[model samples]
Target: NGFKLKEGRFKLDIRKKFFTLRVVRYWNRLPREVVAAPSLEAFKARLDEALGNLV
Candidate 1:
């Protein structure tokens, strides 16, 4: 998984268990980002990693 700034938004490529999910969330509206995961730990880890890369 990787992230980069493109155009004017943060582009994220997150993968787990062989599946990849692409997400585009604006930096200004990060608080509104919704991420669904199978477990609380997974959700937190993924979200942290994704947001970490953006920063």
Candidate 2:
């Protein structure tokens, strides 16, 4: 059977303008691994790319 997954919000690192995650241990269950982004807009763009790469 496949995994039952959930995605939480991206928590911001205010000093660096980058985003972090709520869940860290479930990376292996995910098809796309997250990359830290410099801004919200950049994060969205990269998120779209990650989703697009998913089969």
Candidate 3:
């Protein structure tokens, strides 16, 4: 149902029979960043957007 990244400090929840996934990041820090209602393709798009934003 879910997977986590130790270094990046992010968690992903992929549910069955659902068109959306959830992403939770920065759990160890205050005011954790959580994102939901993201489709698989939209998730990838967000990743690309983040990379571009960092550039």
Best by TM-score: 2
Task: Give the per-residue lDDT of model 2 (tens digit) for 10-36.
Answer: 455552332333343344334432444
Q: Give the TM-score of candidate 1.
A: 0.37
Worst 10 residues of 2 by lDDT: 15-24
Q: Which residue pairs of candidate 3 clash? A: none
TM per candidate: 0.37, 0.38, 0.35
Report clash pairs, candidate 1: none
lDDT of 3 at 22: 21
Tens-place lDDT digits, model 1, residues 1-55:
1333243323443332222222333432334332445678876887787778778
Instruction: For model 1, give the RMSD to the true fold.
Output: 12.2
Q: Which stretches of candidate 1 lie over 4 Å from their true place?
A: 1-34
Question: How many collisions per candidate?
Answer: 0, 0, 0
Error of 2 at 52 (Å): 0.3
Between candidates 1 and 2, the one scoring higher on lDDT is 2
Q: Rate the local accuracy (lDDT) of all candidates.
A: 0.46, 0.50, 0.39
Q: Compared with the true structure, what per-residue lDDT tens digits does model 3 show for residues 1-55?
A: 1343334322443342233222323322212112232576765676566556668
- Badly placed stretches (over 4 Å) of model 3 are 1-37
